[model samples]
Target: MKTTSTDESSAGGVTPVAPDAATLESEKESMLRQPVAVWATALACVFAFMGIGLVDPILPAIAENLDAGPSQVSLLFTSYFAVTAVMMLVTGAVSSRVGGKRTLLTGLTLIVIFAALAGTSGSVGELVAFRAGWGLGNALFVATALAVIVAVASGGRAVAIILYEAALGLGMACGPLVGAVLGDLNWRGPFFGTAVLMLIALLVLVVKLPSTPVTGERTSFAAPLRALRHGGLFGVSFSALFYNFGFFTVLAYTPFLLDSGEYGIGLVFFGWGSALAVFSVFIAPVFQNRVGAANTTMLTLCGLVAVYVLLGVFHGTPWVVTVLVVVSGALLGVNNTMYTEMAMSVSDNPQPVASAAYNFVRWMGGVIAPFASTELAEKFDPSVPYFTAAAAAVVAVTVMLFTRSAVEVHGPHAV
Candidate 1:
C-alpha cells in the first residue's frame, strides 16, 4: 500500500495543501490584531457613521422647535446626501494630491466645525446648510479611511474590509441610541454631542495616526465619472441608486408616521440599527455565500419591497410600523453588503475610482428620497411615499436581474 505525504496528497493534480490548524489560527490572530493608528481611525469612523442616524431621534423636535414642516426638515437629508454625492468625485482627487492624512484631518475638522454650527442654528435652513458642509467633510474622510486601513492593517484586504464593516455596523447601531439620550434633553443636544465626540475622535487620530504620504499616481477629478462608462459598473450603480431610494425613505420619513416621543423613536431605531449591525457583520456573508451576490441582492430587494408595502398598509399602527422598520434593517443590511461587493468587483476601474463612481450615483437616491417622500406624503397621502419606495425596490430588483450576467462575469470568486 502506498501512503501519501501530508504536503503532497493529490493523486493526479497539483492542488495546494490546505493550511494547517496552527497556520489558520495564526492568520486569524493577525486579522484580529490592529495597530494603534488603525484603531484610532476606526474609532473616528464610528463617530462618522453615528452622524447618519444621530438626527433621527431629533427630527420631530427640530420641526417643532424651528416651525418647519416635514418637507422642510427632510431637506436636511437632501442637502447632506446631495453634497456628499457630489463630493465623492472630488475625494479621490483631493486625497491623491494632498495625501490621506491631510485629507482625513481636513474632513474631520470640517465635521467638527459644521456639526457645532448645526447645533447653534436658529432656523431649519441654517441647519440644512451646515449639514451640507458636514457632508463634504464626511465624504472626504470616508472616501480615504478605507484605503488607509487596508494599507496599514495587519491582515490583508479581506480583514481590513471586515474591520471597516464592523465599524460601520457599530456606529450605525449606536447612533440612534446616543441621539435619543441626548435629544431627550434638547433637540440640539444630539448635534452638540456629535460635535464633541467627533472632536475626541479627531484628537485621537491626530495623536495616534501617522501621516500617510501619497504613494502612487494622482487620480483625476473626472476619473470617477468616466468609470461609469463600464456597463457592469453603471448597472450596479444605478441599481444601488434605486435601492437607496427605498432605504432612505424608511430611514428619513418613518418617524413622522409614529406619534412616539424622542425616546420612543430612539428605542425603535436602536432595534432597527441593532438588526442592521448584526446582519451586516454576521449574516450577510453567510447569506451571500449560500445564494450568490446577484441572487442575494434580488432576494433582499424583494424583502425590502414587501416590507415597504407592509409599512404602507399599516402606517397608522405604530407597533406594526415599528416591527416592520426593524425587520427592514435586516434586508437593508444584506442588500448594502451585496451591492458594495458587486460595485467593488463588477468594474475594471481602479477600486477607488469605481467606489467613488458608485457612491456618487447611489447617493442620489438618498438625496432625492427624503424631499420626494415628504412631498409625496404631503401631496397625496402618507402611504404614497412608502408605495413609491416599494416601486423603487422593484426597479432595483429588475435592474439586478438584467445585469446579472455582466456582474457575474466580472465579480470576485466568492461572488
Candidate 2:
C-alpha cells in the first residue's frame, strides 16, 4: 500500500485531503459512470452558457419593455462579460481554496437571485447594475466549472474536456429555443426558468460531488503574474481572448445575415450548436490524441478563415451559408478544446494564474467582438465582420506558427 503522508496543519487546519486508493478508485469510477457530479457540473456549465445567448434575440423587446435605448440594452451583454472578465482570476483561486463544488453553489445562487432582479427591473440603470451582478455569478461558475471537471475527473483530461464541453453545446443548442418560447410569455420568464435549473443542479452537485483538495495557495502578490509570464503563457492567453472575440463577432449577427426564414431556428442551432456537439463528442479526441494540439489548432484556424470568407462571398445560398457556419462551428470547438488543453499542459505549476490569464485573454475578445461587429456594420459592409473574423483567425494561426516551439507535455503524469 502506498501510504500517503498527511499534513493536517495546512489549509487553515481544514483536514488535509489525502488522495488515497479508496478516494482515487471512487473518483475513477465516478468519472467513468458520468455520475451526478459530472452531469451536475456539466449542467451548470450549460446553464451559464445559455445565459449568454438567451438575451440576444430579446434585447430589443427588453429595451422597449424597460423604456431603454439600444446602447443601454447593450449593457445587458457588456456588464455580464465585464464582471466575468475581472473576477475570473479571483474565482479560480477561491474555488481552488474552498473547493470547486462549494464556490459553484454559491455563485449559482447569486446568479439566480440577481438575474431575477435584473429581469424585473423597471429602469435601465437597475437592469444594468443587476446584470453586472448576474455576471459576477457567471464568472464564478464558468471559470471554475471547467477546472473542477479537470481536477476531479479520472477519465483523463481529454474526457473531462469532452464531457464538459458537450454539455455546454447542449445548453447553447437549447438556449434560443428557450428564449424564443419563454420570451413570448414575458421577458423575465427565461431568467426565472434559469434560476430553477440552477437550483436543481445545485442539489445534484451537493449530493454527488466529492470535495476537491485545495489546488493552490495564495502566493506572494507578484508570483502569479510572474508564473504567467513563462512558457508562452501570454501568447496563449491573448489567443484565448481573441478566439472568443472572433467567434462571437460572427455568431452574434449571423442569424440576421443568413437567416432567410427557410431554415428557421432548428437549422441555425443545428448547424452551429450541433456541429459543436458532434465535435465535442466525436472529433475533439482526434486533435488531442492524434493530430496534436497545435497542429489541430492550425487546421481549425484555416477552416475558420476559409469558411468565414466563403460565407462573405457566397452567403446568397442558404445551403452554402449553413455548411460554412457548421464547418466554422466544428472548427471552433476543436480550436478551443485543443488550445485550452495545450495551455494548461504548458506550465508545471498549479494553474490558477495561468487559468485566469487565459480567461482574461478570451473575454477581451468577447468584449471587443460586439463593438467590432456593430462598428463594422455602421462603417463597412455587414460582411466586414465575417472577414474580420477570418483575418483574426489568420493572425491566430500566425501566432501559433511562431509559438509551436513552446508546446510540450504540461503535466508529469499526462496521457
Candidate 3:
C-alpha cells in the first residue's frame, strides 16, 4: 500500500504537506552546492572584503613608520570608507553600462593597482591617497557582488545572501590575522599581500565567470539616491547607518582599549570574525526560521545594545571587553544578513541599484564611527564611546521598531 505524506482527516480538511527528510536535505545541501561562478565570485568577495580590516593590526605601525599622528593614520579608514560610500552612487551606473563581469574586473584591477601603490608609498599622505583609490575600486566590486551572487546562486535569495555574509565574515575574520602576521614583519607586507591575493581572484574570475554585459536599460547616476525614496528601503538603510556606528565602534576603538600587541589584538578580532562567520552562516538562519526575520533583527539589535553597554561597564577589563567584542560579531553577522536580504526585497529597484543605495547610507556610519569613537575616547574617557555606541544602537532599535511593518517577514524562511 502506498502512503501519502499528509493527513486529510482533520475537521478543517486537508492538512499542509510538510517537507520530508529528503526534501529538507536537498534544500540544505543546495546552499553548499553552488556552481563554479558562484564560488568564484564568492572567493573574490572574500579577498575584496579582506581589504576592510587588513590595516587594523598595522595602524600603529603605519603611524610610527611614516612619522604621522594617529589622526592622520586613522585617515586610512576615513579615506577608504568615505570614498567607498560616495562612490556607491556610481557602481550601478557603471555596472549597467559595462555589465557585471566587466565592471567587476575593472574594480579588481583598480584595487590591484592601488593596493600595490599603497605598499610602495613613501609618505602617509601617499598611502591615504592610494587607499582612497582602493576604496573607489572596492565600491565598484562590493556593490555589484551581492547582486551577482543573488542572480546566479541556487536555492534562493536566502541561501545566496547567507553565502555572501559568510564570505564577509570569513574575510573579516582573516583580515586581522593576515595583517598581524605580515605587519609584524613589515607594515607594507599586508598591502602587498592583499594586492597579490586580489590579483589571483581577478584572474580566477576572468576564467570562471562568463561575460554578462547588460542589455537592459542603463541605470542612471541618480538611481541609487532615487531608490531610497521607497519607505522600506530607506528605513532599513537608515537604521543600518546607526547600527553600523555601533559596529565600527567595537572594530575601530576596541584595539586601543585592549592595549595588546599586534598578534594579541589580531587573535581577538580573528575570534570575533570566526564567531561572526559561524553565526551568520549556521545560527542566524535557525533564528530566522524560528522567529522570522523581523523579530530576529529586533532581538539581535537589542542584544547588541546590551553588549555595548556591558563593554562600557567593563572598559578597564581587557578579557571581558575581548570576549564582548567576539560576542558582538554574532549579533553583527545576523543583522548583516537580514539587512541585506531586506534591502534587496524591500524595493522594486534592481538588485544592484538597491544594494548601491543601501550601501551608500550604510557606510556613512563606517566613516563616522572610527574618528568619532577615537575622538570621544580622547576628549572624554575610554568608556564614553561604548556608551555612545549603545545609544546609537538604541536609536537603531527605535528606528527598526517604527519601520518594522515595511520590512516585516511573515513565514519562517521568507526572504
Q: Could you give candidate 2's per-residue lDDT for residues 23-88 as a string of tens digits?
A: 545544645676566777887788877777666546656757888655456666667788888787
Q: How accurate locally, in lDDT, is each candidate?
A: 0.84, 0.67, 0.85
How many clashes (backbone N, Cα, C below 3 Å) per candidate? Answer: 0, 5, 0
The true-structure Cα RMSD of candidate 2 reads 6.5
Which regions of candidate 3 fall more than 4 Å away from where they truly are? 1-24, 409-415
lDDT of 1 by residue, 1-415 (tens): 0112345433321222234556545545775789999889899999999999988888989999999999999999999999999999998899889998999999999999999999999999999999999999999998788778877897544456656776877787799899999999998998899999999999999999998788679999999989999988899999999999998998899988876988888888888888887787667766765566788889989889999999999998999999999999888877777777778667667667887899999999999999999999999999999999999999999988988987766563231
What digit string (tens of lDDT, one per residue) describes model 3 on residues 1-415? Answer: 0011224322222222334566556667998899999999999999998888788888777878899865677778878899999999999999989999998999999999999999999999899899999999999899988888988998756678889999999999999999899989999999999999999999999999988968779999999999999888898899999999998888877877787878988899999888989988888867765665667888999999999999999999999998999999989988888877778766667779999999999999989888888888888888999999999988988888877877653122332
- TM per candidate comes to 0.92, 0.83, 0.93
Residue 369 error for model 3, in Å? 0.5
Decreasing TM-score order of the candidates: 3, 1, 2
Model 3, position 47, has a per-residue lDDT of 94
Model 3, residue pairs in steric clash: none
Between prediction 1 and prediction 2, the one with superior TM-score is 1
